[model samples]
Target: MSKTILVVDDSSSFRQVVSMALKGAGYDVVEAGDGKDALGKLDGRKINLIVSDVNMPVMDGISFVTAAKQLAAYKFTPVIMLTTESGDDMKAKGKAAGVKAWVVKPFQPPILLDAVAKLILP
Candidate 1:
């Protein structure tokens, strides 16, 4: 079965782009406007991976990751932070939150797909 990836970003266009890439790569895509919305969408669903934006209105990616890790259903689900931030402090926070990978914005689809393939739960 194809893996399901939850993509969380405030920008609708970014979500569209990521969703298109994941779908093209034979992965199912679930989109959310922000971290809160992403958490809402994760009700017992088996999400193989998560790709999130760090700077958002509702809940930032790091905060979301911390919250997600506390949940039994998502404790082990890998997260990829897709954002414009590339600072060491932010990356460290993401790592502490259990994020598995980091992808900067304006990214190439092929590269993002490669990261997904490498990190998505089997």
Candidate 2:
């Protein structure tokens, strides 16, 4: 089966772009507008990975990752933070929150895809 990914971000355009990129690479893609919305959509669904962005309203990416990892079903699932913030503090927090990877914004699909492939397939 194809890998299922949940993408959480506030930007409609960013979500569309990331979804298209993942879909084009043959992975199943699901989108959420924010952390709260993403949590609501996780009911009994099988998700192999997550790509999230920081600084969203109604719960940010760090909180989302923390909450996601608390769920018994998603304890070890890979969550990657894709955001514009590149500070050490943010990255450190994401790491502590059980996020497996981090990608800075204005990114190329190929680069992001590479991380996805490695984390999901490796």
Candidate 3:
């Protein structure tokens, strides 16, 4: 089965960019504007991985990762934070929330693809 990835970000352009990258690499992609929307989208979908943004309108990536880990179906889903923020404190917070990795924004698509492939398929 193809790996299913949930791309969560408030920026439509960023989401589109990430989705295109993932799809190009042979992964199925879904999109959500925020954590709340992402949770709603996850109801019956099989999400293998998550690429999220830290700052958003409804809910941020850290909250999304923490909430996702609580559900049995998503307990082990790998979530990577793709954001502009690269502070140590933000990274620490993401780590505490069970985010698998943090990628600074303006990131290379290949790097993000590699991380997703390693985490979801390894």
Q: For this target, which candidate reaches the highest lDDT against the unseen true structure?
A: 1
Q: List where candidate 2 sits over 4 angstroms from the true fold.
A: none
C-alpha lDDT (0 to 100) for residue 76 of candidate 2: 80
lDDT per residue (tens digit) for residues 1-122 in model 1: 99999999999998999999999999999999988998899899999999999999979989899999999999999999999999999999999999989999889999899999999878
Off by over 4 Å in 3: none
lDDT of each: 0.93, 0.92, 0.91
Candidate 2 lDDT by residue in tens digits, 15-50? 999999999999999899999999997886889899
Indicate the worst ten consecutive residues by lDDT in candidate 2: 113-122
Tell me each candidate's TM-score: 0.98, 0.97, 0.96
Deviation from truth (RMSD, Å), model 1:
0.6
Off by over 4 Å in 1: none
Order of candidates by TM-score, top first?
A: 1, 2, 3
What residue pairs clash in candidate 1, if any at all?
none
Worst lDDT 10-window in candidate 3: 113-122
lDDT by residue for model 3 (1-122), tens: 79899999999999999999999998999999999999998896788998999999888889988998899898889989999999999999999999998889999998998888789944
Name the lDDT value of residue 69 in candidate 2: 88
RMSD of each: 0.6, 1.0, 1.0
